[model samples]
Target: MLILGAGQVRQALDGAESEVVEAVRQAYRLHERGLTELPHSVFLRFPDSARNRIIGLPAYLGDDTPVAGIKWISSFPGNVAAGLERASAALILNSMRTGQPEALLEASVISARRTAASAALAAATLAPAGPQTGVSLIGCGVINFEVLVFLSALLPELDTVTVFDLDRSRAESFAARCTARLPGLKVTVADRVEDALAAHRLIALATTASTPHLAVESCRPGTLLLHLSLRDLTPETILAGVNIVDDADHVCREATSLHLTEQQVGNRDFITASLGEILADDGYRRDETALTIFSPFGLGILDLAVADLVRRTADHLGLGTRIPDFLPG
Candidate 1:
């Protein structure tokens, strides 16, 4: 098996945001083609710790790219206290024909970038046609940071950003980082969630909160809420919006945003359409007056898309560790 480390993954992803977005868009299109088999992610939760226990995502992408991979990831929010990353992940790609492991890769970077790419794609597709002038980011962690970068790339009208985090120091640190990366974009630290939401018509939620469901009353009308954290918006908030999901079944089952709504409403009928359906031109329509919410359950097709790119790039650069022949003779 071939093993690609984090450095290799980062190198492969450098300046590859647009390609990643296109890959994710194609994956969503294939999803609408009914050619992929992606089960709802399996979650292991530890209530005692304010972090996800672990998550296992398995998927098979059909079409021109016939591949299957599984990502095993863990989240430990306390890792930041130790000066370590909050999440760690690894992915295993298997040969479709022989069912043998082909490669093992460090997936943390891929996971973050693919996710950010998806959000950026959705924003480009769903947000208003005008420039994305103002954006409010709810979390200042790794995911939101990447989201900001990709969103800026997609929506060049984005010249100002409002950031908020529970920790004051973290918010300040993130603001400084954004200033460095985006020289002209103004970055402001908001004192509260409402302040953050009200500051920008474009809002991205990437918090670690498992049960944070913000009310629509706190947001401006026509605001595009990018619920990247999965379960950050309440049913009332979601129901009030022109809701779009990556996959209706997957998001309703595992999306932290939709999970709470399903429990409260006892059904998943509130979802208007999947982003794939819209991208596929499958009779999906959007309402201008309604609040727009896009919840993605982090599909495996995305993982495979990014992983395929990484694998190909790593092969060209000779960056990954290769094992002796693992296939039986």
Candidate 2:
């Protein structure tokens, strides 16, 4: 077995945002071709801590590059108070031919980057044409930072970013980091959530809130809202938007944004389209006059895609720890 560490993964992913986005697009296409199986993620809850939960997502990606992987990610919202990230993850990739464990890799950066890449890809695919003038980032954290990096690539016209966070220092720090990473982009720390929402027509939500909520009354009509934090938008907000999800069955079931919307509205038909269907040339039309929301439940195919890339790159560069053969020949 080969073990790829975080540093190697980060090195392999550097300046590869466009490639990752393309991989996500191809994964969606594979889904359309009926070559993938992504079941709803399974959650393991902690008995004592309300904020602690671990998720297990398994996926199989078929076609020429056959592969399978599982992402084990844990979320502890309280970790931020202790100067730690709210989420951490690892992925295990297996050989498709023999179903043997091939590699184990750190997934924190991989997960964040692939997710942001997918969001950027979706925005490029569905958002209105023209310069991407402004964007609002709801959560000023690691994920949102990476999201900005990917968005900058997809929307080169992107010049301004409005940021909001409950913690003022965090928001300021995030803005500073953005300015350093994306030299030409302007980062403004908004005083309030509404202020951030009202300033930008393209909004990205990456908060840890499990409930259905966000104050966006001041948001302009036809704003493209990327609900990267799963269940951040209220059902009323979802109903008012041209809703798109990564998967209908997985996201509209029990604990995701679509699921919360279904519980609130008492219907599942509110979803307009799935990413796969949209990529498949299904008649999924966008309502230009309506608000748009894209909620992806964080598909495992993305994890697999990044893992495949890292594995190949690490193999070529000899970057991982190759374990001695445990199974005797």
Candidate 3:
């Protein structure tokens, strides 16, 4: 077995945005082609902590080089209040040929990177061609931070960003961090969610809002909304848009913004198409008169794909610890 720590995983993935996005794109294609199996993510919630839960995602990506894995990830929003990261994760990858556990690796980084890659990939696919000079990020969290990191590669022409968080200080700090990481980008802290939502045509929503808050009128027409957090928009707002999701069944299960839209409408007629379908074909057209919401339910295959990449890269770079005959003889 090979063991990869968080630091090692980070090192292996550093500056590999293009590769990671390609891997995520392949995973999406595999899933769309019915070459992947994804069980609904299992959630473990604590009665005492309504806002926190741990999720287990099990998936198999079938292709010429098949892979299977499970990601165990925990999210504790209060951790940010305590000056700690709000999420942590671990992944166990198994060899498809022998059914033996091949590697155990830190997964929070993998999770974040894949997520950012997916969002960036979707943006690159759906967004209109022009100057990507401005973007609005509605949540100043780790997820959006990573989104900006990938966007730096995916949309290098972005010159302005406006960010907002419930906690203004956090938003300000996020801006400072972005200014440092992405030079020549003007990062501003928005005082209101509506202000942030309206700051740019390309909007990213990654807040931890437990329930619906955003309304349909918050954004202008033709807005490309990356609904990363999944629970930030109201049912009416979700139904009012041209929705694109990673997976319809998965996104509609967790009471995400899109799920809420489904619950209210009693159908998924509003969904435009899966992101994979759009990525697979260049002839797909976007309705520029409507708000385009891309709400990804965070697929397990994405984690498996990114984790496999990290494992192979680490192996080539001699970056992880190898444990010989640890499972059984």
* Candidates' C-alpha lDDT: 0.86, 0.86, 0.91
What is the Cα-based TM-score of model 3? 0.98
Q: TM per model?
A: 0.94, 0.96, 0.98
TM-score (C-alpha) between model 2 and the true structure: 0.96
Worst window of 10 by summed lDDT in candidate 2: 280-289
For candidate 1, lDDT tens digit of each residue in 164-186?
A: 99898999999999999889899
Q: What is the per-residue lDDT of model 3 for residues 114-199, given as tens digits with 9 covering 90 to 100? A: 99999999888887756677889888998999999888798878889999898988899999999999888999998888888888
Q: What's model 2's lDDT at 288?
A: 65
**Which runs of model 1 end up more than 4 angstroms from their true locations?**
46-50, 282-286, 325-329
Number of colliding residue pairs in each model: 3, 0, 0
TM-score of 1: 0.94
lDDT by residue for model 2 over 113-181, one digit each (tens)? 988988898788786745677899999888899999999999988999999999999999999999999
Task: Please say which candidate is ahead in TM-score: 1 or 2.
Answer: 2
Error of 1 at 129 (Å): 3.6
